[model samples]
Target: MKKHNYSAGPCILPQEVFEKSAEAILNFNNSGLSILEISHRSKDFVAVMDEARALALDLLGLTGKGYQALFLAGGASLEFLMVPYNLMKENGKAAYLDSGTWASAAIKEAKFFGETVVVASSKEQNYNHVPKGYEVPADANYFHCTSNNTIFGTQMKEFPNLDMPIVCDMSSDIFSRVLDFSKFDIIYAGAQKNMGPAGTTLVVIKEEILGKNGKTIPSMLDYAKHIKAESMYNTPPVFPVYASLLTLQWLKKLGGIPAIEKINNAKATLLYTEIDRNPLFKGAAAVEDRSNMNATFLLNDEAHTPIFDALWKEAGISGLPGHRSVGGYRASMYNALPIESVQVLVDVMKDLEKKVSKTRL
Candidate 1:
C-alpha cells in the first residue's frame, strides 16, 4: 500500500506533477535538455518562470490588481527579514500577531528593524487558538500575521482591516483555500508547502506597497530590485521554481484555488470529524480556529499510543506525529493529499476506537 504522507513541509504534491516533473528531468519540452540544467535566461526557462509568477497571481486573483509574484530563494525565513527591510522604516514600527513558532520568529526579525508590537499572542495557551480582539497599531508600517500555524494547527479566519500594509506568511496554506488575496499588501510562502518544493519562496507584493519605506535595502533583500528584474535578480532556484510552476499548473488545471478549497475543506472535515467523534482522541487546537490544512490531535489515553501508532503505521499512514514542541499527531492535508488518504486515517481511528470499546466491555 502507498503511504499517506502527512509531513508538514516538503509534503505531497499531485502525482501528475511528479510524473510530469520526472519526464521533464529526462527531456524538457522536447528540447532534449533537462529542466535542472536549463539556464534561467533561456527562453524556455524564462517562460516557465513567467508563467509560474503570473499563474500564481492569477490563481490568487491578484492579476490586474497590481500584484507581482516572484519565486525567490532563502524561503519564508528570509522573507521574515526582507519584509521589514523593504516595508518598515528605521524608526517605524510593525504590528504582529503571535500565533505560533513561525509567527514568533517573524516578530523577532521585525524587532531588529524597529519596534515590533505583538498585538496579541496565544503562546500562553500553547498556541491552540488564534488571538482575537487584538488591535493593530494604526500608526504601524505593516501588520504581519501567519495565515495558518502549521505547528499548532490554528488558522486566522478573518484579518483585521488596517490602514497600514498587511503582510501574511501563508507558507502552509497558500493555495489550500480561497481568500481575499487582494486584501494583503505582501504575502509570502515557501515552496516546500502547498506551492511545490523547498528551494524557492513565493513573494506576492502589491506594487503600490514598494519604495515607500525610506530605507536603503540591500540589493539581495530589496523586493523592488527583484520586481524590477522580473524576479531574475541573481540566479533563481531553478529546479524548485520549475517544480513550483508545475504545481501551479496542476492547480490551475484543477479549477484553481476555489475548486481546490472545496476538496481541502472536505478532507479536513473528514479527519477532524473523526478526531472529535472518536472517544479515543481529541483535537489539540480550538475547534473554531482549527486549520483546514493541518489538523493537530492527541490520543486520549497515552496507554493506547502504542496500539494507535501501530495501527496507523500498519495502515501506511506516514508523518502523522506532531511537532516536537507539541506532541500527538499532525495530519497535514495539503492540496495534493487525496480525500482517500484522509479516509484511510479515519478508518484507522475508527478501528482503534472499536477495539478500545471491545476491550473495555
Candidate 2:
C-alpha cells in the first residue's frame, strides 16, 4: 500500500534525497568511507559544506548580498534563546508578533535576555488568525515573527516593513515559497521540515547585525562565531546536512521556489477546498490566514471521527492527527509532497461525507 505522509516536523523529504542519503551512509562519494565515519574537516566534506551554503544563498537570491548561511547543531528551539541572546541588548527592546506556540516560545526566551514586547497577538482568538495593525516600535532592536505556525495552522500573510532588523523562524515553511529574502536580517529553520531530516538547523543572517549586543553571548550561540568558522565552529550534523544538501539540489532542479510555490499552493487548495465543502469537517483557522504548509481542521461530529480516521488509514494515509494543543486534523503539505497525495486525502473526506449521509438516511 502506498502511504501519504502528512507528519509535521522530521517530515517528508524528496525520495531522491532519501535514496542518496542512504547510499552515502554505506559509501559516501565513492570514498569507501560512510558519511557517518568521515571527518567533517576533510577536503571532500568541506566542499560539501561550501556547496550547501552556496545553494541556500542562491535559492534565496541572497548570493553576493553579504549574507552568511550557517548550518549548526541546535534546532529552532535553541534559536529561540540565541536570537535574543545575540540581538537584544541589556536595555534594548525587541518586538514580537505572537501567532502560535512557536512564536510565543520565542517571546518567552527573548524576555529572559531583555525587554521582549509582544506588539500583537492572536491568542485571544486561539491563534486562529494573524494579529494585524500592530506597531513595531522604532526603538526596538529587531522585529521577530514566526512565518508559519505549525500547531494552529495560521501564517503571516504579509510582513511588516520596519526600519529595525527583521528576524523570522521559518522552520516549517522555508523553501516552500518565494519571499523577499533581503527584507529579513536573520532567518532560521530546522532541517526536518521542507529541507531534510532532524539534527541540524539552518541560520541565514545579515553579517552586519552581529556584534551589536552589549551582553556577551556564548560562542556556540553567537552568529558571528559560526559565520567566521564557516559553520565548522563545532563538528556539524553531517548526515542531516548532507541530506539537506541533496534536497536543495532537488529543489534547484525543480526550478527553485517559484515553481515549488505553485505546486504547494495547488496541494493546499485541494485540501482546503474539501475542508470547506465537506459537511463533516470544519477548518480551525481563519480562511485569510490559513497556512499553506500546515492545514488544520476538525470533524463536525466527534462520533464520526473514528469513521473518518479508519477511512484515511485504510486509504494508507499517515500522520493525519493534529497536535494535542489543538485537537483535530493537521495536514502538513511540505515542498516534496505531491499533489496526488492531497487529492487522496480530499477523496477520503468526500467518501466520509457520503458514508455518514447514507447512514443518517
- The lowest-lDDT stretch of 10 consecutive residues in candidate 1 is 133-142
Candidate 2 local distance difference test against the native? 0.93
The digit string of per-residue lDDT tens for model 2 on 32-75 reads 99999999999879988999999999999999998999999879
Q: Each model's TM-score, in the order given?
A: 0.99, 0.99
Instruction: Name the lDDT value of residue 124 in candidate 1.
Output: 94
Error of 2 at 96 (Å): 0.7
Candidate 1 TM-score, true structure as reference: 0.99
